[model samples]
Target: MRWINILLGLAVAGILGFYGIRELLADPVYFLELFLGGLVRGSIYALIALGYTMVYGIIQLINFAHGEIYMIGAMTALIVASVLGLWGWHSAVIAILAVVFAVVYSCAYGFTVEKIAYKPLRTAPRLSALISAIGMSLFLQNYVMLAQTPEFQPFESLIPDFAFWEPYAHIITSVELAIIITTVVVMILLGMLIKFTKIGKAMRATAQDKIMSSLVGINVNNVISTTFVVGSATAAIGGVLIACHVGQINFFIGFLAGLKAFIAAVLGGIGSVPGAVLGSLVLGISESFFTGYFWSEYEDVFAFTILVIILIFRPSGILGKHETQKV
Candidate 1:
């Protein structure tokens, strides 16, 4: 099965490369631009993907309101940056602070959501829990819309100019650099924490069997809450990055971003960290290519198509393991 997956991956890469070469033959610079755009977009997807993977790992339940959680992050960051920038703070510093605050607030929000909407259902039927999740998602969305005007607002001030000198040309954009650096750094720190720390082991054990973990003296509730906090914080960072990249925000911003991130998590393997990153990059790059080479209208279709294909071929996902039920 592993060999089959590897062969399939190689085959897919070959097909993409062949098409890319053909496209390059027609217009080389365009291809390069598309490639770069894909990488940037992929980083954003990876950030959001982390949130989904982390929460799913510990709870085995999908927090449908996660996207709304992300929206809160972006909305909060936008408000902070706008107010602070008006007060004469450096735009870069304001943006950074906004991101930090957004993450912290989002983490708190995640904890609250778990406590209010999920904790009670921990011992309930799976179907009931799922319905509750959907309800929570809708409630959060409408709550945001009611609290703030639903109209889209420009987030231009949050993005600062960044530049780098390259041998070929000078490429600069603080927004782009910020997204890449933030995502990479966060992923590295997360990877290290999960791989080397005691808390990470607790998380893994809890994921494998919450009851067993509790029996072994782990605080199951604490671990689960921590997982939600970590996931929400990462999603908040993703929201800020997306808002900066798009230069605008609306109450509905989280819907699509959350959907894509969820798809990325499934693609990578829901319980696998590296899988989420890979899935996110694939989704991001696919969307970029669709928008760049084909039509923007097809971007969503392209993303969903990839998800469907992955599901058909690898039902457990690229890096997911099959679980056995205890009789």
Candidate 2:
């Protein structure tokens, strides 16, 4: 199976490379611009994918409200920055701080959601748990609509414009650069925490088997809650970056982003961290290329089409493992 995956990957890469070479020959500058744009876009997707993968790893359940959590994070940051009267450099600092605060708040919300909605249903049927997730998602979305205005509002400018180094090509905006840098830093820190920390070990143990982990004296509930917190925090960061990039937000901001990030998670392999990153990059780059070379109308189609093909050929996902049930 691994060999099959390797071969398939090579084939796909070869096809893409061939087309890419043709495009480069036709218009090198344009190709470079598209590639950079894709990377920036992929950073946002990767940030959101972190949340989905983390929650799925620990609980084997998708937290559908994650997107809403992200939406809340952006709103929280925006509100906080506005309250602080932050603009330019000060505004940028406030925005970053606000995002950090939002992450903390979102983490708390995630922990609460797990305790209130998921923990009680842990021993229940899987379908019941799934329904609960859906209900929680709807509740969060509606809660925002009721508590906050549904209309789109512009985000306050936080960072001053920096001079562009690329005179011929202006592919990388300051917001795009910030998104890429922030995503990389967060991912690196997370990777380190998971790889070299005691809590990380506990998380891995709990993910493998909760009952066994509990029996072994691990605080299974705490680990589970921590997992949710981590996932939600990452999602919150993603939301902030996305809002800053687009310069607007609304009550339903999370719906489409969440769906896309979910697709990215599945495409990369749900349980694998690196898979999520790779999947996001592939999805982002593909979408950008299609939109750049073809038409914007086909952007969404291109992403979903790739997803369908991936599912048809590799149901377990590109880097996902297939679990065999013992009957």
Candidate 3:
């Protein structure tokens, strides 16, 4: 089965390469533009998917409320930016402050949610936790709607266009460049944290076995809460970047984005960090190419179709290992 999956993957790659080469030959500029656009989209998806994958790695729960955490991040940024704008603060300063507040608030919300909704249900049935997650999601959505109007709010781009980047501006804007760079940096830092830090080591051990980890000196609860905080921080960054890119946001924005990121996580292998990033890039690039070459209206159709195909062919995902339990 593993060999079959490999061969199938190779075949799919070959076919994609053939068409990609042909498209590039037909229109080099357009092809590169679409590819870059896909990278930007993929970067955003990867940020959110990282949060999904990490939390799942630690607790094996989907944490549906994560999307709301992301929404709160964006909303928090909007509010900060708006107030700063009114005060005539520097654009760079406003951007930095907004991001800081977003991350802080989102992290707080994530920790609180884990304690209130998930921690208490730790030993309960998985379905109970999942239902609680859904309820929490709905609660956050309505709470945000009531707190901040349901109407779409305009968001100004905080990323500044560099004068030196004028030549390449046509290929990709400053915002897109920032998103890609930020994702790369964040990924590298996360990799280092997981590989070197003490908390990172604890997270790894806990993921392997909760009881054994607890028996050994590691604080399982602390590790779990830390996981939520880290995931929320990454999702908050994604939220701010995406809000700046889209120029407008509403209370419901996170629902669709979160759903797409979840699909990306599953496509990449939900519990694997690298798998999440790879899957997001693949999904984003595929969506970009499909929308550019085929039908823009059917972009969502294409994404979900890809997810269905992946699910049918590789239930464990591209990088996920199939578990075998001893009877």
Best by lDDT: 3
Q: What is the Å distance of residue 104 in model 3 from its true position?
A: 0.4
Residue 273 CA error for candidate 3 (Å)?
0.6
lDDT of each residue in 236-319, candidate 1, tens digit only: 988888888888899898888888888989988987899999988877777877798788987888888878988877867888
Per-residue lDDT for 32-70 in model 3, tens only?
999999999999999999889999988989999999999
29-129 per-residue lDDT for model 2 (tens digits): 89988998899888888988888888888888887888888898888888887777644456657866887788888888888888889999988987888
Q: What ranking emerges by lDDT with the best candidate at the front?
A: 3, 1, 2
Query: Number of clashing residue pairs in every model?
Result: 4, 0, 0
Cand. 1 TM to true fold: 0.92
Pairs that collide, model 2: none
Tell me the alpha-carbon RMSD of every candidate.
2.5, 2.6, 1.5
Better of 2 and 3 by lDDT: 3
Candidate 2, residue 309: Cα displacement in angstroms equals 1.7
Candidate 3 displacement at residue 38 in angstroms:
0.5
Question: Which residue pairs collide, candidate 3?
Answer: none
- Name the 10 consecutive residues with the lowest summed lDDT in model 2: 160-169
